[model samples]
Target chain A: MVEQALENAIPGDWRVNERLKEAAIYSLAAGGKRLRPIFVLAAAEAVHGDEKAASLAMPFAVAVEMVHTYSLIHDDLPAMDNDDYRRGIPTNHKVFGEATAILAGDGLLTHAFYVASEAAAIGVPAERTLAVVRDLARLAGFPGMVGGQADDMEGAQGITSIDQLEHIHLHKTSDLIAFSLRAGGHAAGATDRQLEALARFGTNVGLAFQIQDDILDITGDQDKLGKPVGSDERQGKVTYPYLIGLEQSRRRVEELTEQAISAVRSAELADSGRLEQIAMRLISRDN
Target chain B: MVEQALENAIPGDWRVNERLKEAAIYSLAAGGKRLRPIFVLAAAEAVHGDEKAASLAMPFAVAVEMVHTYSLIHDDLPAMDNDDYRRGIPTNHKVFGEATAILAGDGLLTHAFYVASEAAAIGVPAERTLAVVRDLARLAGFPGMVGGQADDMEGAQGITSIDQLEHIHLHKTSDLIAFSLRAGGHAAGATDRQLEALARFGTNVGLAFQIQDDILDITGDQDKLGKPVGSDERQGKVTYPYLIGLEQSRRRVEELTEQAISAVRSAELADSGRLEQIAMRLISRDN
Candidate 1:
């Protein structure tokens, strides 16, 4: 359902500029784990204990995925990480050329809000939809993802401590993840206390996810990861494993996952089982 | 007031990434005409005939300017127009490396929606605010500016006619300008007829503004324009004068401006006088 929602989010044949649409759709369709959108749906389901409520969360889900995908496209630019491939396919700039890729990223980022505002049309309260729009921008924007990226690039030359690594990971990864979960809860009319629980759960899960990524970079199969390992070392990026060792990183992932599950469980949600299981699965996934 | 609002629009000391903030502010401060924001305010005042209501339009005004400024930053990138200078100063990428500039542009673009959502806190109806947010994204995203830019780049090889040039100008330039006008009208609680009139007026004025830019490139003072002249020829870009002859282009500008003024008059807004004057002045401006 999430996959189909994403597919239908952007028009395949916008008459204004087919190449721009094509470039944007290409990156979006390249397919990451779709973890962010799934998180949104799961959180919504947790709040209401019904699939229909989760369905209302689909717009937020698709919107978050678009934001994530656009960030990946920009992050891979020659001036940034300069990665030539992602998810076993050529990166956007590598495929569409740098200028078009940049614009495609812009299109996706801008259109994400259009998609999110769509919730109002689907019966979500206008006030909630507006709040979601604001939060999406705040989390996906400079205060969150963009700021973290800028800090990461600036500190790339010398990030020596676990604290620095954690700070970057929180803003770079956890903010959007937390937003995804919180948006779903908000859509389902979760109370302030329940929303806070989802945020805590999301932040822990996001950190665990990053730690697992660091671990996978050291020990995972190239075929499953779809990109070469050791890229952190190649890029001189300090990661959880680099700062705390592989064993400690693995332990941290488990701890964070457990904390995430506990937060979900304590929220008194209609059913926290799915969210708790997803947290566990995240830590165990190879990619 | 516009300048002060623009200054306050971004935090001077955001702790997350000060460098990124500086990069965005640098370009924003390297002043253009500030025409878009002024159009926003003028349209709002036209609807309600009061300065207080126009003040209420300030957030929308500032948001549109941020969008305009971001587009300029990205447009001047090495992969795009590749210009080293804008407004007689180093471009954003030139001043703050390409990577930071890219991130800064992304920051500005994403934060635009956040800024627009501020209208709600200032007492704009939630439904109206949501509509504005959606319109902002649609006019600024794939269906509008980004698509226009992609089309311009693809058609750069052989844009041989006035129709093609106008098409590019409408999307690339007119859409955002129209959005600025319409957003202001929406904020002022204008009727649908009034909003449509603002759109018509803005579209005509925007086209006239672009034509005047083309004319100024050939005939205006370099000091007045603040950048090199004849860049259109240098970039092999097709402009109004390039396709229609200088005399015809000048005549077309007058026609569009007249049409814009007529639109304002036809709306029978509470005060159409200022909007009409803005359109008339647009065609006659030196830069």
Candidate 2:
């Protein structure tokens, strides 16, 4: 369902330009776990707001995923991490050239809000949609993703402390992921208590997910991971595995994942079991 | 007023990060004509909307200018136009390093929507703000500015036809300008006919503006224009002066400017004369 929702999110219009659309759709279709969108749906379901609210959250789900995908595309730019491939295919810049790849990222970033703002038209309250738009923009923007990126780039080849790493990871990885759950809760009109639980859930899950990613970068099969492995060590960037030993990093991932599950479960959410499944799937996934 | 508004628009907090804010503010303060925001304000004023309504439009005006400025910053990137000097000073990337520059552009673009979405919190109706947000996302997004940037890059060394040049200009140069007008009119609650006129008015003025820009590249005084001259010829990209000769291009600029003025006049707008001043100032101004 999430995959279908994402597929349907790209507008079938020539006006956005044929090639530009192709560039955007290309990275989007080059799939990830679709974890972010599913987070939205499960949180919305767990909140047990109006059943129809799940329909409204779809756009937010898609918007979060688009922002995530665009970030990956930009992250892969030659001016950036310079990765040559992603999700088992050529990176966007490799396929479409640097200029188009840059613009494709710009297009996706801009389109995310365009999709989010539409939530009001579909029965979500205007204020609710407005709040969600603000949330995504901030998370995907400077104070969140961009800030982390700037700090990470500035710290290249010499990150010394775990605190610094967490600062980077929190903004770079966790903000948007956390926003997915918070925004889903918002769309579902979740109570403050439920929303708080989801925010904690999102943060812990995001931290765990990043550790799993670091672990995967070190140990996962190239075919399964899609992109090349060992990029962190190759680039000499610091990560959890590098800082605390691989064994410790694996333990940390399990601990964070368990806490992430606990946050949602102790809230006694109506759909607690399903939300736990999401947390487990995210942490234990091979890719 | 617009300058002050823009200054106030930058959030005064460490959350945005000091260096990141510096990068964004550096280019914004480097300054251009500030024409886009001015266009927005003038259109809003011409519509004779409520006085408080002008306050509502200020955010949009600021938002539009940020988007415009961000585009200029990204356009100056080494990966894109590869220009060094802008407004007679070092480009963002040249001063901030490539990664910071890229993140700065990302910061500005994302901040734009953040600022624009706040239009509702003040006094503008939520629906109206949503419409303006959508308009910007589309016009500045892939189908609009990014699409044009991609095409312009693709055709840079080999633009063959006038049609192709116009296609580039329409998206690259005109869409955002036109959007400024329509959005301003929207904030003022202009009638449909008036909005249509503003749209046409924007297109003509934008085309004229581009011709003037091309002309300036050839004939502009180096100190006055701030950047080096003859870049079009240097890069071997086609432009109005290159295609039609300076005299013909000058004539075309005048023709388009007049048509732009005539568009609003024919619409029998509430304050056509004020609108005329904007068009004339845009067409006739020298750096």
Q: DockQ of candidates 1 onward, in order?
A: 0.84, 0.67
Clash pairs, candidate 1, are: none
A243: Cα error in model 2, Å: 2.6
Q: Which candidate is the best by DockQ?
A: 1
Worst 10 residues of 1 chain B by lDDT: B9-18
Interface RMSD of each: 1.0, 1.4
For residues A197-228, could you state the per-residue lDDT of candidate 2 as single tens digits?
99889889998889889999999988888778
Model 1 lDDT, residue B231, Cα: 81
Number of residue pairs clashing in candidate 1, backbone atoms closer than 3 angstroms, sequence gap of 3 or more or interchain:
0
- Model 2: per-residue lDDT, tens digit, B173-209? 8999988888788888888899889989888899989
Candidate 1 Cα misplacement greater than 4 A, ranges: B11-14
The prediction achieving the highest TM-score against the true structure is 1
TM-score of chain B of 2: 0.95
Root mean square deviation (Cα) for candidate 2: 2.3
